[model samples]
Target: MSANIILFHSVLGLREHERHLAGKLGAAGHAVSLPDLYAGVATDDLEQGFAIKARIGWEVICQRARDALASTPGDTVLAGISMGAGVVASVWALRPLTAKVLLLHGLATVPANIRPGLPVQLHVADTDPFFPEPDVRAWQHAAEAAQTDVRIFRYPNSGHYFSDPALPDYNDTAAALLWQRVLAFLD
Candidate 1:
C-alpha cells in the first residue's frame, strides 16, 4: 500500500494535524511531502489565516506547489485540506500524470482532460460555510463531466474544519471515519 504522496496544508498553514496525517501515511509505508504554503507562519484566527494567504499570494503558492511536485513521481497522489485542496485543484491540469486526488474539508474541480476513472475523493462538512451545497454541486458536475471516479464523503452538522483535532470544529467520530476511508483509499 505504499504511495508517493504530496500533501498541501490548509490556509492556517502547515499545522500539526497535517503532520500527523503525514506520519500516519508514512507509517502505512507511503512517502509523503507536506508542503508549507504559508512558509513557517501559522495561525488559528480566520482573519489572520486569510491575511497570510493574501500576503503569500495564491500564484506564489501555486509556484511553490509546482516546485514541490517536480521531484515526485508522475503517478503521485495529491492530497490537501481546505485551502490546500484549492491549491491542488489549481495545478491539477498541469500535472497530467497525477494518479489520484484526495481533498479534505473542501471540493475542487477536477481537470477536464483527466482520464476517465482517475480516482478523486472529497471529504467535506455537509453544511460547511466554506463548502456550500452549490459549490459542491459544481465540483461534482465538473468531475462527472470528466468521467472521474469521484466519491464525496459528507459529514452532516460538522464544521468546516472538523478533521483537525486542535480546532474547536474537530469531530472525533468523523475524523476517525475519514482516516479509515483515507487509509483504505491509499491502500
Candidate 2:
C-alpha cells in the first residue's frame, strides 16, 4: 500500500535533509512532495529560523501548506519535521481522510474529527527542549482519548533534530531506527 505523502520541512526551511528524506520515501515506492514554506530562505540557528517563520507569518505558512496539499489526495499522509509538526496540526482538521501522520521532533494536536484507528507516529528525543516529557505525555493521552492509534518513539540522549545529519544534533543510530520504523509504518 504505497502512500501519497506530503513532507513539510522544519523551521530551518526546505533544505537537503527534507529532500533526502523525500528521495528515500520515493525509493520505497511512495509518492512524496516536499514543500518550501520559507520561499528559499533557510537557517541552521534556531532563533534565526523562528525569526524567518515569524517574518513569513504563521497564517501564510499554513496557507502555503494547505496549498501544497491541494494537488494531492485526501488520504495523503502528512509528515513534518519539528515546527512542521505544528503545521500539520494546523491543517489536520481540514483533511479528515489523511492516511496517517508522521511527526518527527515535535508533537501535533489530534483533531477531534480524526478517523478512528488512524495511525500517528511521533519520533522525538527524550530530552528535546522543544518537546518536554510532560507535553508529549499530554499529547499522547489526547490522541488516545480521540481513539486514534498512536506510537511514540523517544530517542534517549539524542538531540531535537537528531535525524538530520546536517545538524550537530544528529544521531546516526537513532536516525536509522527512526527511518526503519517510519518505512514500516508506511507499509
Candidate 3:
C-alpha cells in the first residue's frame, strides 16, 4: 500500500531538509518526488525566501508545481512545507483523485470540490505567527464540513519550521513526533 507522493518545497526552495525527508519516505517504501519550484535558488532567511518567491512570480511557481505533477499518478498524495502548502492548494482542484494531503508548517485552502473521506493531515506550531489559531480553526472546519477527514497536530512552543534541523527554529522533540505521525499517516 505504498503511496505515490509529490512533495513541494517551501518558499526557501528545495534544500537538504526536503531531500532528507524524501529519502526517508523512499526508505519507508513510498514513491516520492521533491520538486524544485525555485529552480536552483535557495535561502536560509525567511524574508529572502519570500523575496525569491516574489521574484519568481506566483503563476510561474504554480505552473512549475503543476508541471512536476504531470508525470505522477492521479492519486498521488500531495504534500508540502510552508509556502508549498499554498502550492498544493493551487493545484488541488485539478487533481480530484488525490489520495491524501500532508500540509507542514502552513495551511492551505480546502477545495470546495474535495472528495468525500479524503484524508488530510496538518502539522504546525500552535502559536506560529504565520498561521494564526483562528485561521487554522477555520481551515479545519471548512475541510471537515467538506466531508474530508482532517487531523491537526499543533506543537506547543515550537517554531514554525520545527521539523527542519538545519533551521534555527528546529525542535528535536517536535520534529521526531512529527515524523512519527507522518510515517503513520503515509502507512
Ranking by lDDT: 3, 2, 1
Evaluate model 1: give its TM-score: 0.97
Candidate 1 accuracy as lDDT: 0.89
Stretches off by above 4 angstroms in model 1 are none
Worst 10 residues of 3 by lDDT: 105-114
**Taking the candidates one at a time, how many backbone clashes does each contain?**
0, 0, 0
Best by lDDT: 3
The global C-alpha lDDT for each of the candidates, from Candidate 1 onward, is: 0.89, 0.94, 0.95
Write down the RMSD of candidate 1 (Cα, Å).
0.9
lDDT of 3 by residue, 55-89 (tens): 99999999999999999999999999999999999
TM-score of the candidate numbered 3?
0.99
User: What pairs collide in candidate 2?
Assistant: none
Write down the lDDT that model 3 would get.
0.95
- Cα lDDT for residue 153, model 2? 96
Off by over 4 Å in 3: none
lDDT score, residue 26, model 3?
A: 99
The best-first sequence of candidates by TM-score reads 3, 2, 1
